[model samples]
Target: MKIAVAGKGGTGKTLVAGGLAYLLARAGYTTLAIDADSAPNLGFLLGLSSRDEGAIVPVSKNEALIAAKTGTAYPGVYSLNFTVDDVVLKYAVPTPAGVHLLVMGTVASMGAGCTCPANSVIRALLRHLIVDRDEAVVLDMEAGVEHLGRGTAEGVDMMLVISDANRQSLAIAGRIARLAQDAGIPHIALIGNRIVDAGQEQVLRGFAKDRELVVTGMIPFDPAVVRAGIDGNSIATLEGSAALCAIGGILSRIDQEIKERLNGRVDTEKHS
Candidate 1:
């Protein structure tokens, strides 16, 4: 299953992504967790030490690799069809929590109408991961869906728009849903984070209903999560965490959705 988690800044989307990836890995799936955010904190949430996090060179900033794959031609020339199949094995950092992480930093702009080498490599690598890889892939994306083009979006099985019970957050979630739909993402659902009460849940459900989106899950506001963040500890290490429990349910729903899709396909084949 290929999933993308996105939300407005400070909505705990990274936490959702990390938790889902951890759960999937623990369930015996080989998971690749990609940090596609500009300010990458999935490493921290995934329990990577500060030193290990610092050691990770984001693909977008790796000049030599980018040049090697995209060529050194300036002004008007570069290879758009470069191979990035080995990038995961070559660059992914395996965490003790059992997920392989690949950080794709933000691409630098080279004026207008020029596709930078870093972007080219990142796009190719993402395509390979989403379309070719058999493992469960989770992308912790930026606030917007800018990194996901139509081709890449189509390959994703689901996009979970995480949001809090706030107007601005819900508004952004609506925008993200529309953008993901425009990019051909088939399933888009809302995951409510930091929901404190029934009122908060109602707010999220109402917003999702208004936007014609599904509310797949709701994660309550857990003090353990805040404490972990403050202590620079991994939330996954908190055994029996309420937030984690909620996320596990969400993952189960996602798994069931995948199975339903496969069963639907099989039924269609049998009928045909």
Candidate 2:
């Protein structure tokens, strides 16, 4: 299964993405977590120390690697037909959470149709990971779906648009859900995070219902999650955390949804 976690900034989408990746890995799926956020803090949630996370370079910023993959003999010209299947094997960082991470950084030219070399490499690599690879992929995307071009977005089985009780966050999540739908993602669902009570849950559900988006799961306000972030501890090691438990439910829902969708497609093809 391939899922992309996206929401407005500070809505805790990265935490959800990382937590899903860890759980999928624990469940015996070879999982790969892609940090496509511009700020890129998913490393912290995946058990990387501050030093290690800081030392790692994002794929878009990796000048040498980008050149090797797309550079040409002529100045200002680059090739687009090079293979990117080896990028994961060569650059994916193995984390303590047992999930490999590929920090793609921000695809600045994404969706703008710019054929720049770096964008080419990044886009191709993302498509390769999502479409070619068999492992479960949890992508922590930027605030919007612009990073996901049509081809890259189609490979994702689901897009989890996370939101909090805040109105602004919910609004952004609605927009993201619509964008993911337009991008041809099979399943687009909303995940409510930091929910404080039934009222907050109701609010999230109401918002999603109004927008015709499904609410896959709701994560209650968990102080332990806040403390873990403050203390620089990985959620993977934080047992008995309510937020993690909630994310586990979300993961199960995502898995089931993808399976059902795939089965439905197979049935349709058989009938056709």
Candidate 3:
């Protein structure tokens, strides 16, 4: 299963993304967590040491790798097609949370029609991970709606748009949901994060209802999550935390959705 977690910054999307990866890995799935954010901290959330995380290089910023993959004999041109399957084995770093991490720094856009070599490499690598790989892939996408274009998230099983009760976050979540839907993402889930009470939940649900969207899940504000951020500890280490418990419910929802989809497909086939 491939899942992409996106939201306005500071909505705890990384925590959800990292938590899902850790849980999936612990559940015996070969999980790969991609930090596609410009300012990445998924490695820290997955319990990668500061030194180790610091030593790692993001794929888009790797000059040698990009040059090798996309470089051509021409001075002003680069190759547009290359196999990126080997990149995972070569660059994915193993974290203590049992998930492999790959940092894909922000892809630069020179113009509306421009396609830089680095951008090509990232697009191909993302497609490989989402459409080609068998492992459970969790992507922590960058803030706003830049990361997802027409086909950027096409093969992803689900796009979890995280939001708080606040209007700014919810607005961004709505925009993201629309973009994901336009991108042909099969499942787009709006998750309310950092919810404190019934009022907050109501606001989130009311907003979704007004917008004709569904609230797939609600994550309460857990103090343990706050402490983890303050203490610089990984959410994987917080056993029995309320936030993690809620995330567990989200996992169940995802599994159920997938199962139902498969069953529906089989039913359709039988009828046909």
Candidate 4:
């Protein structure tokens, strides 16, 4: 399953990615969670500390390829010899619940000329690193579909657009859905993060319907989550945390949707 979680800033996209990755791993599936967001909070959420640059791998093509593509003068003798996997790092963090994790480095925002490299880096490797894998991969993408780059939107299986109660966040999520649609991405759903109670749900559901997105689930603004983060604990490892409970519900729905989609595809293949 290739699940990509994207949303406007501060919508808790990274948390959704990390939660699902942790959930699937605990469910006995080997999972790879890629933190493709420019801010890259998954490392912090997962409690991974690394001074080594290896922890944050770069997405540069082979030095030769980069030079060739950019028409840059070669610095010196070089051999083009690294495959995509060579650039990814495995962060093996132990969880009491037996969920395995592997984290990728961050990307800069899709901002200006200075961000061109990060954007290109994300665009280039985004495809091969995602849909071409056997193990389930979850991508935590930046707000909007900027990470989809150009002409490769078909690789994403499903995108969960995160949003808070704020209108700005909701507005951006609608834009994200449109971008995903433009990228030829097939499925999109919405997750409203930081909902205080069910009373706020009326507002959330109305916004979701107005935007033509599904209000899949809601995560409460739990202080336990904050405390867990403060102590450098994995949200996945948060015991008796309300945030985790809500996230688990979200994961269950996602799993069901994946299974139903896969089953439907199998039926289509058989009838054809």
Candidate 5:
């Protein structure tokens, strides 16, 4: 299963992505959590550290350089420069948690027509890593759903849209949900975060009602999550805590939904 956790910046999308990876791994799926954001953070969340030992391979594409390499050949004929392995970072990380991470390569500012080449390579590598490798890959993505272009991993099993209790956050969340729809993404669910006040519930319900989106689950405001992120604490190690309990339920729903979707697809194929 390929699941993406995304939302506006600072909405705890990475936290949910990291926690979901941990939970999925614990369930024996051999999960791979990817930090596809240019400025990556899933590493810290998953409790992995590089002693600044390995080079941060810039995954960005220098379209000009690549064009030069192609020597006036058609852009379509220009082969990609980096391999999937070249961009994937194997942090000399030691964790009993049993998961792996890949950082999306990054580069500085560029021209208007230039989208991050690293983004292209990373997206290709992500497709290879998730669909080709068939590993349970979770992408901790940046805010905009624009990252997911057409004819890519548009077939992902789940497109999780994370949001907070604020209106601005919900606005972005709804926008992404529409993006997912435009691509005809198979599954889209919302995870509302920093939840408090019963009124926030109404806002979410209204968004779901107006947009017809799925509220997979809600994560209440929890300081444990804050401490966990700030301290690089392993969420899998949290025991007998409210935050952990909430996470457990969230993970359970993910599992249940994945199972149901897989089963539904299988039955459909059989009938056809």
Candidate 6:
């Protein structure tokens, strides 16, 4: 399963992405967690040490590697097709919990102007990871789906738009869902995070119901999560924490959905 997690700043989307990846890895799935955010903090949440995090040079910033894959000469002229199969093996840092992390910093040329070599390399690598890789890939994306082109978005199985109880966060989530839909992403769901009480849950449910959005899961506000973040510790390590338990529930739901889809496909084939 290829999943993309997105949310406005301070929404704890990174935590969710890291937790999901950890869960998949712990379940014996080869998981690749890609940090596609501009200010990538998934590394920290995934329990990478400061030195290890600093050692990771994002694909977008690796000028030499980008040039080698894309082109050397002109700015606009570059190869759009490049092999990125070795990227995971070569660059991905293995965590103690068995998840491989690939930090994809923001695609610089994606802002304005023609696509540059960096953009080509980043896009190609992302496409390869999402479309070709068999492992469970989790992308911790930027606030928006700006990095997701039509082709990349189509390859993703699900897009989880996380939101707090705040109006601005929900608005961003709605915008992200629309963008994902426009880009041909098949499944889009909202994850309510930091939901403190019944009132917050009701607000999220009401928002989803009114907007016709799918609420995949809700995570209760846990002080343990906050402490973990403050202490620069991995929440996944706190196995019995309320937030971790909630994330496990979400992962189970996702796994069940995947199983159902696979079973449906097998049944259809048998009938045919």
Q: Best lDDT goes to which candidate?
A: 1
Ranking of predictions according to TM-score: 2, 3, 1, 6, 5, 4
Lowest summed-lDDT stretch of 10 residues in model 6? 108-117
Clashing pairs in 1: none
Between the candidate structures 3 and 5, which one is better when assessed by TM-score? 3
Question: Model 6, range 1-272, lDDT digits (tens) per residue?
Answer: 99999999899899899999999998999999999999997888877899999999998898878877888467667777778788788889987657999998977634354487777777778889999889999999987777777788889888999999999998898888888787788888899999989999998889889878888899999899888877888746678888888988988988788789889999999999
Query: Highest TM-score, which number?
Result: 2
> How high is each candidate's TM-score?
0.95, 0.97, 0.96, 0.79, 0.80, 0.94
Q: Choose 3 or 5, whichever is better by lDDT.
A: 3
Worst 10 residues of 3 by lDDT: 143-152
Error of 5 at 166 (Å): 0.5
Model 1 vs. true fold: TM: 0.95
Whole-model lDDT, candidate 1? 0.89
Q: Please state the error at residue 145 of candidate 5 in Å.
A: 2.6
- Each model's lDDT: 0.89, 0.88, 0.87, 0.67, 0.68, 0.86
Candidate 1's error at 122, in angstroms? 1.1
Q: Candidate 4: list runs displaced more than 4 Å.
A: 50-57, 60-85, 89-121, 150-152
Instruction: Give the per-residue lDDT digits (tens) of candidate 4, residues 121-206.
Output: 44555665675657777787777665664445677667888888888887888888888877788878888888987767777788
- Please give me the total number of clashing residue pairs in predicted model 1: 0
Ranking of predictions according to lDDT:
1, 2, 3, 6, 5, 4
Q: What would the per-residue lDDT of candidate 5 be over residues 1-272, giving only the tens digit for each residue? A: 78888898888788788778887888788788876666776665565555321443333434443343333356445455545553334432334567777665453322123444444454566666656667688888776554555555465778899888788898999888887777667789988787776788778878887888988887778877777766767666555556566666887887788898779999999999
How many backbone clashes are present in model 6? 0
- Which stretches in model 6 have alpha-carbon errors above 4 Å? 72-76, 108-114
Candidate 3 global TM-score: 0.96
